[model samples]
Target: MPVENSRIKGLYKQTVQERLKLVAKAAGLTDEHVQALSNHGELDDVAADRMIENVIGTMSLPVGVATNFVIDGKHYLVPFCLEESSVVAAASNMAKRCLGHGGFTTNNDEPVMIGQIQLLDVEDFEQATTNILQAKHELITFCNDVPSRMIALGGGCKDLEVRRLNTHMGSMLVVHLLVDCRDAMGANAVNTMAERVASRLEALTGG
Candidate 1:
């Protein structure tokens, strides 16, 4: 569903709790979500340690609001967390200056990424390259066959490319898998696909 207008005047003047309530109501957020945001000390030592390596204490940064942003015909009050002064003010000033020209427009392509697999110690580079090219469809299908929620969401391997590289050690072959990850970052998905196809690639290249 499309978002309604975000032009909430005097939002920055309100207290933290009042601003949270207003934002929750405007965004159709549940009471539980609002309560979570309102609560302090939410991230204790245990939670902080679990989130990253080493059991160090948590750090804090000042979060300020930058107002008067109209992006794509929708107004916004962007929250910025930083230690430097005048950053938020500068951004708000720039955004207000651009409002007369339909604000900022953004364009993004499909979220596709490349996964590379390197093959070394090949006996015959020419024949191995030919074999991999011949089995391109099978390799792509193999990558898509893995149990991934991304594939169910209309995202998976899209194309394959092979390149031959000459290193100081010897000749090496690299296979590139082009995958569309939809809304995900796709690091895990791409790495898993590369790992799954490694053995088959070894057999084909006699690596």
Candidate 2:
């Protein structure tokens, strides 16, 4: 069956159980989904511990909905789990006010990031900078050569940058690898590239 309408009248005025039943019926949710939603302690200590380093208990937050949001011409009831008061109310108010204009529109850009490699204790900063700049293509190729699913998906190292800095301890060189991460956050990929190119960078900088 197709969903004809999502605008439920006075859904916020209903009781918790009443609201759940209405939402479940409208969304064609199963009994298991409703049960899971109603249950409090869904995450046990073992699961929580595996998720994070601490072996302590889990914290709880109240879940509320901000209604009347129409993004890209589709209605959405956003769920927010927050401790601050009036946030849900404020969001709902703003969304309701904006409904007359066409709700919200969003644009996304291709994800790109820089991986920084810091080379300390450089004997000659000028020579080290020149050496790294001269080997820019090689360094960028080394980064792109790393085995990554992102590279296969049309994303990898784009360019290399060299910066020389003078500090209280000594002079150092910082190498930046510009990368296109595609859809991922790129932290792991960037860090891996930085670690793989560190020895070559050290040799170039004589640090």
lDDT of 2 by residue, 1-207 (tens): 122344556765665566667666766768886776555366553443334221112345445556677787777766665556667667877888898899889888768899998898888888998998899889888888967899999999988888877788876788888889999999999999999999999988888
TM-score for every candidate vs. truth?
0.68, 0.66
Q: List, residue by residue over 16-127, the lDDT tens digit for candidate 1.
A: 5565566666566677765555443544534433333211122343444455577667766565644566676577678767877777777799899999999988889889
Candidate 2, clashing residue pairs? none
Candidates' C-alpha lDDT:
0.72, 0.73
List candidate 1 stretches off by more than 4 Å. 1-64, 81-85
Candidate 2: residue 21 Cα off by (Å): 2.9
Best by TM-score: 1
Best by lDDT: 2
Q: Please count the clashing residue pairs in each candidate, in the order shown.
A: 0, 0
